[model samples]
Target: MNWYVVYTKPKWEKKVAEQLKKSGIECYCPLITVMRQWSDRKKKVEVPLFNSFVFVQLPDSDRNLVFQSVGVVRYLFWLGKPAIVRDEEIKIIKKGLDGTDSCEITIVPFQIGDKIALDSGPFSTQTAIVQEVNNTHYVLVLESLGCVLKMKYK
Candidate 1:
């Protein structure tokens, strides 16, 4: 069986994943706990890491089984075929979210005015220029996109 990406209705990633599981289909919807502030109060909620997206592992012949779940729009495509998610990639996501304190991450030092390329997130593959650097955060300017991004260290 191969893992394929599924597009779900907005704000429905978790529901779709639950439905797929009930049908005996293996699925993964990575979630993160985020702090949300409202006018009245602030709360922490678990939200899908990738909005409107979920991953399902199923054989090619059983691909249509996913349609039985509501909110599932369609399989994500790449190069005119269904996008495949490698098992190792899935393991990495799981390990990162497990919060076991065993994962080690090293941040490479960047100097101001240095050119860099984003490897992940919504701006993946886009080149940016380092504009400012400080102890807590850094600013990047995406000239092609005409936007400035500020990333904070955790």
Candidate 2:
């Protein structure tokens, strides 16, 4: 048996995985937890590592059952052909899932309560309080300006 990508309906990867599992197909969908803040409270949500795609370990004979299943978009390749994913990559991903490495660390975003020191830039070697953490940048309250400034970190 080999691993193949199964294209799922929009935002239905988990549901498709469930259905495929019920049909005796082995499915793997790795997820990572992210903190989502709401008006009243903050919650940790498990989001898919890949969007709209679920990997399945199936042979050619069982591929038909998944292809005919509802909520599956396709075999995740051009013209419905099975796309090949390198076994080494799958093994690495599986190793990550198995906690073989240090991939299970919770990366807490630099939030208001957390302290951060600038590694470079005009604020290099300076410590700043995290006012907000946004996509592609971090809004920091510089001690010199008494105002918030956005800084990009790789």
Candidate 3:
């Protein structure tokens, strides 16, 4: 058995994980608590660490079983094959989140003017150039899509 990445509908990570678990499929949807502000009030909410993604552990033959659950789109693919998450990597993620009072994970550093391909979302497979970078967000120019995308980070 191997751990595979599952792409899901936006904001459905937790729901899909719950469904998978009820069906006896072991899954992981890493979540973190963050303060979100509304016009009237501010509240702390738990959100998935990786948006629209959940991890499932199952044998290769059972991959299709995940689709029976609503909100699951498909398995994430890499290099023309389903992406596999190593067991050690999964353990590290669990340990990092479990062992910390407050944990911060930094993605690879992106510099201004660096060109990169989006791995997920509506912009998946599109190449974008980094227009601006800061501690809270990134301004990306998606030439193919003819739009500027601002991505926020914690």
Candidate 4:
């Protein structure tokens, strides 16, 4: 089996994967976990690492089947030709997927005093001081509010 890249319609990765499976194409789509907060509550969610693409393992004879499949835009290309992914890179990705719980969230590294653009909450777009850092989250003090908020970065 050879690995090929399949580009999908915007936000259609999962749908395309399902269709590909029914057509007997083996595929992989890595996901990252995120913490989502709403007005009344907070919960964990998983999102794709690459927004609208998936890797599929298929033979050359069935390659056309993929091109004709619904939700598939085309194989990833360069110089007007289908591009090939290196075996080593695919192996590395497979290793990471095999080793970790894909839903395990992690933090973005922050150095002390680093100026950060707030990504969410009431202070969105404001600058804050990175007071502390930990796995999957960080502590930022909103100077004007005199309150420190814990935020998930990954």
RMSD of each: 7.9, 7.3, 10.2, 8.8
lDDT of 1 by residue, 1-154 (tens): 8999999999999999999999999999999999999999999999999999999999999999999999999999999999999999999999989999666789889999999999989999999999999999989999999999999978
Write down the worst ten-residue block by lDDT for model 1: 100-109
Q: Per-residue lDDT for 54-132 in model 2, tens only?
A: 8998887778788666789888785656786767888788777665456446876777757778797776887778877
* Superior candidate under lDDT, 2 versus 3: 3
Between prediction 2 and prediction 3, which has the larger TM-score?
A: 3
| Candidate 3 wrongly placed segments (more than 4 Å) | 101-154
CA error at residue 91 for candidate 2, angstroms: 1.9
Against the true structure, candidate 2 reaches a TM-score of: 0.61
lDDT tens digits by residue: candidate 3, 49-138: 999999999999998999999999999999999999999999989887785666668887899999999999888999999999999999
How accurate locally is residue 72 in candidate 1, as Cα lDDT from 0 to 100?
Answer: 94
lDDT of 3: 0.95
Candidate 2 least-lDDT 10 residues: 96-105
On lDDT, the stronger of 1 and 4 is 1
| Collision pairs in model 4 | none
TM-score of each: 0.68, 0.61, 0.65, 0.60
As for candidate 2, its clashing pairs are none
- Candidate 2 lDDT at 40 equals 100
Alpha-carbon error at 93 in model 1, in Å?
A: 0.4
lDDT measured at residue 92 in model 3 versus the true structure, 0 to 100: 88
What local lDDT score does residue 22 receive in model 4, on the 0 to 100 scale? 84
